[model samples]
Target: MTDTAVIELVEHAPAIGRPLPDAVGRALAASRIVDAAPDPYTAGQWVLRAGSKVGAVTLNVPDCAPVTVRIVPKVPIARLFFLLGYSLDSRGWRDEQVEVAEHRDLLPALAQAAERQIDRALRQGLLQGYRDAEETSLVVRGRIREAEQIRRHFGATLPVEIAYDEFTTDIPENRILRATVERLLRLPGVARDVRRRLLHQRARLADITPLVPGQALPEWHPTRLNSRYHQALHLARVVLTDSSPEHAAGALRIDGFLFNMNKLFEDFVTTALCEAYRGTDHSCRLQDPHHLDEARTIRMKPDFVLYGPDRCPHAVVDAKYKKEKPDGYPDADLYQMLAYCTALGLPEGHLVYAKGNAPHTAHQVRHAGTIIHQHALDLDQAPDGLLGEIRSLAHVIAADPPV
Candidate 1:
């Protein structure tokens, strides 16, 4: 078919006013709609065009009626070459119709698809890792094993065992190992097993050195570690130092260990939000702290701020990893959300938390004649349920006429 006819088939096959040619109709019958057209096409409209055609085309949408196309004679069929070439090269369009095959550089698209798959797998792995950490209590068990092993191995060679009534504990295996490795590298009389294990652990955790045949493992020449370990160490140090009562109670206190939890919560919230509003013209802004100069204080950084179609601030959402009470009265959280609403000039803010501690609740508080609504979201439900709650909240915000 001519390029114009082919273009028309693709363009008008999705519309209500147009009829597709017989060949285009066959393509439509075979095509699977990946993305549905919003606002224009009626329900049951076929948005994809695929399969083989025999000259003319017929198109139909279930409630909107159908149209027929007459094949134009002496058409160049150059469009066929483009379609065939694209279909041969593309990945996402593998199962799609030849006519609807999206032609673009395969490398970038493949890379993107691979990246998305990897990210999804990573998220799944992280979640499973947390669960495994909790369930297996691996760190405590591993520490105990290391201590026992050290006591057994070094009890005779070195004075590393701390004696007890019927049992003995190693001189805190990790510290002893660190000290022994430091000393052995200086001298030469270190146990090979001890040095080997320590080196292995360090390499696994710190990317210390490359292991190759016949080359002696390098001594513990410690420099600053990679960004990942450095970040972990920094957070750990903060948590260790700031464990005092005052720091715990302070509003802006940064609990370094909680940073990882914060990141996980952010990921969960972003995923939940995107799933909830899959096709909507809305986007989520994360970890952005909005300042209100009038208040003369830095307001709480919301976990997420959702924007509406017109680029206006729509709603603020905070995802709390902790559980809330059955009455849904998290006073501090409410106050924080109020601050966000005031600063953002939004009508509502959400506080989403893990469920089972409380039933869902909503509150409307009038502040300076503006009604600010507070909502309790239950994370214990399915992801789709969480998304539904977000969609409902967005609608609630939209339905409220300007205050």
Candidate 2:
């Protein structure tokens, strides 16, 4: 629980339960991530283990991360944010970047990102505090609801939908972000002293979640000063999606916070490779697949399929966050890559593992008529270095197979 670490949740990994101070333990009880587990000690605290789902999370509080009874995990939120932020930027999420805190983890990191916007929002005057929109209703009216109510509600204005001009902070976007901040503030690890301040500041915002992303965002004029609000709203919307909200009996409960590095790595490599191959004779397609059977029920999806001069799959590449040992690679991965090669009518496929462990090597599966290349990319390398690995990877995937 050092200042700089976040919790890393490995898929199906076990964590051990440990003792905690009574206050800390009681506070943790409110969290859905940590739970009671079989323990040898009479004190009988709890353990946080990785769930069946694979993901990572940065915590604003200590002793969270909801792992198995035997695990003590620390994730590097700063590193992950840098990688994702880069990918997001390339995908057109541009902004004045937020600084990564030296001592805090993910949720706080998120809070920090939003805090700047929140401050700007306060200065600009609560976005929901501005002008009120006009509306119409039967009883209290800008216009008549008689015909509309007659057609829809049998002409009853008593139980009627009223359209009126009212100043309200209950709008969808504002509600979502406000709720997120309130939820974060209530979590265990958030600094206790900041809670009162944040609550008072956010008092103008009613914590609610009636609106989410797929609904259209409130449009803002593309002017210079309006940038902060837009960026704030965008960050709010993005964070809201990852942190799904649950409400029960007047309390907001969150399913533990986690980010899946597997998907992140897959996307980064796939997208970066595509960018590298831009303007080249060959085209790079990600998650493109061919059917494994005539029925099309089964699919052999490869992360990246590099096309060559013939307009066919020159090579199939798949990314792996957690890889097997070099001596004995995972059979499932072997089977998968082999299928990708066979279905795509290619002779070889490449599996990219994240940890910078083994040297790049190749193996041929028995009677499969295809060879599998295991390439390791060191995620600890600089972002540019990471991209360089993808660039070199392109040569291997796009080049001719060793006959």
The candidate that wins on TM-score is 2
Candidate 1 lDDT by residue in tens digits, 1-403: 2122222233112233333443334334433211123224443333443111212322333332333332221112323222222222222222222221232322122222222222332232211101111111222332233365465665343323332222111112222222222322222122344346435433322321223322332222213422212222221222222121112222222111111223334455555564555577877677776786677575556777877777777777776644443356656776777778788887666766544323467667754443444455554454346557767765664455422
On lDDT, the leading prediction is: 2
- For each candidate in the order shown, give its overall lDDT on alpha carbons: 0.39, 0.58
Angstrom error at residue 234, model 1: 20
Return the number of clashes found in candidate 1: 13
Q: Candidate 1, overall lDDT?
A: 0.39
